[model samples]
Target: MKAAEPPVPGLRQPGERPAPGPADGVSVPGVATPSSTGSTPSPAGAGIRGKRNAGALLPYLLIAPAFVAIAAVFVWPLIKTVIMSFQDVGRRELWTGDPAPWVGFEQFTNILGDGEFWDVVWRTLLFMVACVVATMGIGLFLAQAMQRMTNWVRLALTGALVAAWSLPLLVATSIFRWFADSDYGVVNMVLTKYLGLDFRGHNWWLDPKQGFLMIGAVVVWGAIPFVAITLYAALTQVPKELEEAAALDGAGAAGVFRYVTWPVIKPVFQMVATLSVIWDFNVFGQVFLMRGNKPEPEYNLLGLYSYEKAFESNSFSQGAAISLITVLLLSGVAVYYLRQLLKIGEVE
Candidate 1:
């Protein structure tokens, strides 16, 4: 420019730009330079990401068929039953192709208004409570006893429980019926002859109170195996170290159980109790078979009453309403237990 300034070191000449070097293409160390053709970087990570996503979804996809089958088989039938409860479904509508008229809540209202319905509800509630209490008590006792038993004894007890649990409902009911026979039954013989009691030739099912008790006994007996097995499994999960620590701290056996063991198994105990209540409340086969489908007024539970109303009395909608009520009641128990289970999960 003015007489051309002396050439300075590291300075470019006028109208001249710096040349590209090996360091010019490198924005950071260890990073590759852009391609000569100016193409974008290959998405190599995308394929790996896609593979991971597929793996994550595979378990859900595998279980989808099972969920679909259950929805089709059980859920569909249950929904149909609920819809039929709101309709006036009779023999013609059930057997023939006649359309069932929509009755709304008429069946529900009628059943609610009936004195007999309330009676059966009370009886069922009482029986369910009794059976649940008995089953839980016996089951807990057996579980604790099994925990302390020798291997052979535990094996024998477990085998007996499994065998009892495997017995068919009808078979167990029949066995109970034989045991309760008035003339030559084992119960009366044990009471009158062995125990010197005055129960000989006593017809156990003749009275409503006694009949309910007898049915409850059978329910408790059958339910104990399931409850005991479940409780035992839960008990196995509890560390023996906790019990020992509690004992070393001068806690008695009861104190140790109440403080150390109960907390660990409380969720399982609640679940077992809830299930027992539902099973006892909805028991049909045992009561129906034991009473020969002609249960006395005193012995009529909701299940038996519903069957009688639908089949014998031919009031299909009303029977369905009763069954729906039973379902709702059982659902309440299920919901409560599910909440408890969720709480346990959250705590864990």
Candidate 2:
């Protein structure tokens, strides 16, 4: 090629530089354009600078009042009770606004060694067990029957149960006391007139054994509603397909329940029994309303015992000790049942 004939006038050879100031219509690098005006900040970059914590801790801060309320009402009293259980105070010290005496474990020892305390313990245990068993048994039967009924019948039964549950404990106690009253109660009338039995009803509240039985009966009546509702909910959850499958296999109603329903509901039964035990152990209203101030021959339970020790006998330390024992018993029951409830669903 002609040794590179000079490039054309306005065009340069390949890779050659443009002319001095400008190429075609474009300006040279030395030239400058006007800077942009009225431009906004980048949305993403602006967001980073304007970001705040969004008050992440505001929810917990709002709930602080509730936590304080619970601690002030429940936790503080529980702590005070525990502390008082260990101290000793004479009647004068307890009543005359004097300081409590520090007796350490003496109150605990006294409670353990006391005959009446032990008797109350025995009675409490017996009553709790009996009430729990009777409540659960009747509750289960009623729950099963109600679960199989029409919606109308089920609603009626539920309404009745709710009525029983909603009845004030005092009201129930009054009604039952009137019914069992030896003088003019309807219960004795029915037994004497309708049944025509030789057994003339005596003063149920006057005897401790009879009082315990009456209290248990009243408690069972009130408690069955709760236990029955709990079991009914559990029964409703039993797999309908499994029940149908059992029926298809020529299994009778009892057989199907025994094999399929019982297994599924067994855990619920344990839960109800444990809860009822705790409730029965803490029963004070029924016994207190029926039998007051009397000891072995009339009323015996930890609650009544504590009340008598503190108010009747002026043994504040002993009362606190008994109350603490009751607390421990209830706590143990709660822990046991919590563990059971945790393991309940794992079986299936």
Candidate 3:
């Protein structure tokens, strides 16, 4: 057959006619080219592979900075703290004590057995619940009111809320502390003069019930603004058509809010409540500054207890132990709720 046609490159004899010629878009006698898409397929395959690799690396690239920062700041410190928690700060030879000596879990055991620690734990739990419930209730009401306001009023109200949120945490704490001051505070004066109550000269921090209530009030006030703003944004996303349809069906105001409004805005409520719980549990500066970081058995939360252990008593290990416990507790809450939050839009 014409001297056997010298076998075509990358192909069998002439009957095979090679696979295809990409440029001609047909089978050829010698050239072996991909038939699909009338082009050489290898380059296209390489391009697709490169695109897949980039896609796989994109997420990591986005988060790389955060990971690096965390490792440098938080993760490293956390590891060091955990290590220090296992050491005894007291047994060291003071100036030459090598920082700390290994003491196992003695610090944790001591904290666990301390009655004050347990008391603080109970207070923190109760405080967290009260603050979350109060914040959610007020926030939902404010959000609904915001939704009904005119554009000017909405803008004004939103600005006011943002001011409250943007106020420095320490500044807010100072303002509330001054307001709650028994002798000079305007609040006590109002109570004593207007309400005819003997709130003046009262050490509110000395009384567990009143102290906890005062802290909760300040927390709820500070937190409601944030929650309201968040919920208001979510409320805007709710369809007006759905609300109108409900109204057309003779649904009352209460019915529309209870059914149509609440469900649509429920995600924001859940998110705010979850965050509120964490903030409430970690409340320190407000309560501490109010009492000057002094430990009052009645008002002490776990945070305050940890502060006392670290600074007041110089028990670094105990403080670290309490911190570890609080972190674990908060982490558990985050893990539980984050799973719920990630599933927010899944349900119809």
Candidate 4:
């Protein structure tokens, strides 16, 4: 309603201010001006921000292929195994083009109802616990000893440990089998001739309970080197000054280890223990090769039991169910350890 304002020089419109020029030393609210070099100033931090964003995505891109491969190789098979467990997958359906009929949880129920299965489960648990305890105990002792040994002695011990660790599972099993031979084994000979215990011609693998102990011994022997080396490596990271200080404070060897060294290496020990539990619990090659073509029911671990059910007995569904149970058990241990590690991280 008011009279129109007079046109203003350098104004785009009547209400607008004069457009800023190079000599004016004024800036537009949302526009960038050229610098003294005559090049336009870039949007604030645009190049740096772009580089930061690319860097953030680089790690994910690098790992994507590995993730894809794992998903295809391991995850896919696991999913199929789980699906097969819920279906009736026997020789007919496996060979024929027939669809496997779903019998949800029937195989699991059958396994649960079988007394023999329960017995095997108990034995497997006992075997796993025994091997874990024995392996950890012997490994800890050897690790501590190695830390104090002279260089030459340490070198020899390390070589022996590496040899044991490097032995393949099947090869180690064969070696132990030879050692347990009733007629010619060195073990029986040592007991009979050297120790005067009359263990000659004792068929160690005949009795199921005794066979479990024998095979467990083999597994423990093979497992010890890894655990020992890992613990020793962790021990080396603990500062010698701390141990000396503890010793200076009137702590004996045991007290120094318990107070000063244990805390630093406990995490490594726990990690090794968890791995031992997993490996021991799933051990199949040793027991299978030890029994040699005809594995006894008594010596059947969860791993061997599952194998026998699927391949030998042709009970694929039941075998898959057993494998799932084993997976669940191992997953529980893994989850517990993961939570513990997270707690330690938070505390740190």
| Predictions in order: lDDT | 0.87, 0.83, 0.82, 0.88
TM-score (C-alpha) between model 1 and the true structure = 0.83
Best by TM-score: 4
Range of the 10 consecutive residues with the lowest summed lDDT in candidate 4: 32-41
Residue pair clashes in candidate 1: none
Better of 1 and 3 by TM-score: 1
Tens digit per residue, CA lDDT, model 2, 287-326: 7775542445347688988888887888777888899899
lDDT tens per residue, model 4, 135-180: 9999999998998899999999999999998998889888888888
Highest lDDT against the true fold, candidate: 4
What are the runs in model 4 whose C-alpha is more than 4 Å off?
1-56, 340-348
Which runs of model 1 end up more than 4 angstroms from their true locations? 1-57
Question: Candidate 2: lDDT of 61?
Answer: 83
lDDT tens readout by residue for model 3, 102-176: 899888899889887887898899888988998999998998899779999999998998889888767887887
Clashing pairs in 2: none
Writing each residue's lDDT as its tens digit, candidate 1 over 20-57 gives 55348734545555644375535887788888999999
